[model samples]
Target: MLGAPLLEEASGIGALGIDLTSLLVYLINFTVLGLILYFMAYKRIIGMLDSRSERIRESLEEADRVRKESEEQQESMQKALDDGRQEGQRVLAEAREAAERYREQQAEQARAESEQIVSRAREEIKQERDAALESVRAEFAVLAVSAAEKIIKRSLDADAQQDLIDEVISESNAKQEQD
Candidate 1:
């Protein structure tokens, strides 16, 4: 019995099928409140948040780009360093080989020069020996003729000189055979 008026009011509204004017007024109120909130609060707050988010996103993208570029640069520099080291090693090896070859060539040249010097010395000794032997032979001929004239106490005839030379040659040959 106490809920009769409230129930009747609810039933009366249901029977009338809803108040168009009140509905219109409520919609107008809600729309105005939404507009005010959007203009006064939501728009500003959301705009600040959006701008901050955009700045952060741009900064992150920039950081990523810089990081990628830096990594690429570092890799390139490392490759260059490796290449430089390889080139240096190759040059050093080539230089060492060249130096070794040069040293060997010099040693061979020195050896050839020594051989030439020894051969020239031997030839000089042979030439000197031949000259001395010729000089001695001439002296021996003169001495033998002078001694034959003194021993005989007079000049020898050609026939006598020939006989004397034959005897001297026979004596020299016998002495050489004995020695």
Candidate 2:
């Protein structure tokens, strides 16, 4: 009779296995709730962060492009300014050289004109001096002839008279030259 009751107690041992199955179902429910929360909250936050990062990257790229263009423009402008300054200096130097050449030419012309004027004045002075000396010689000869005619008390009478007057005039001229 004791062995027969012991076998019946052994059959009730399978009821403890049902408790483990119920614990497994509760673990599956907890895992599903955690996944739902992540999809609703954390996914939207990650999307917002990604869009903001893209905008910032594009803005930075545009700024870099603008800066590069500005530098290129400045370099070209600087080169143009330098070229203009060099051209201006070249023009100024050319102008100064031309001015100097013109001045030299003018000075040479003035000197030539002055020489011509002096030469003309000298020629005129020589001519006047010759005329004055000739006039004085003519007057002296007339006076000497008049004085001799008065002293002789006679008029010239042809060939003999001409011969005597020539001899006397030539001798007097010679003595005057010697003295």
Candidate 1 lDDT, tens digit per residue, 11-114?
54475547678789999999999999999999999999999999999999999999999999999999999999999999999999999999999999999999
Error of 2 at 84 (Å): 1.4
Pairs clashing in candidate 1?
none
Off by over 4 Å in 2: 1-51, 139-179
lDDT of 1: 0.84
Q: How does each model score on TM-score? A: 0.60, 0.53
Worst 10 residues of 1 by lDDT: 3-12
- TM-score of structure candidate 1: 0.60
Off by over 4 Å in 1: 1-45, 152-179
Report residue 53 deviation for candidate 2 (angstroms).
3.6
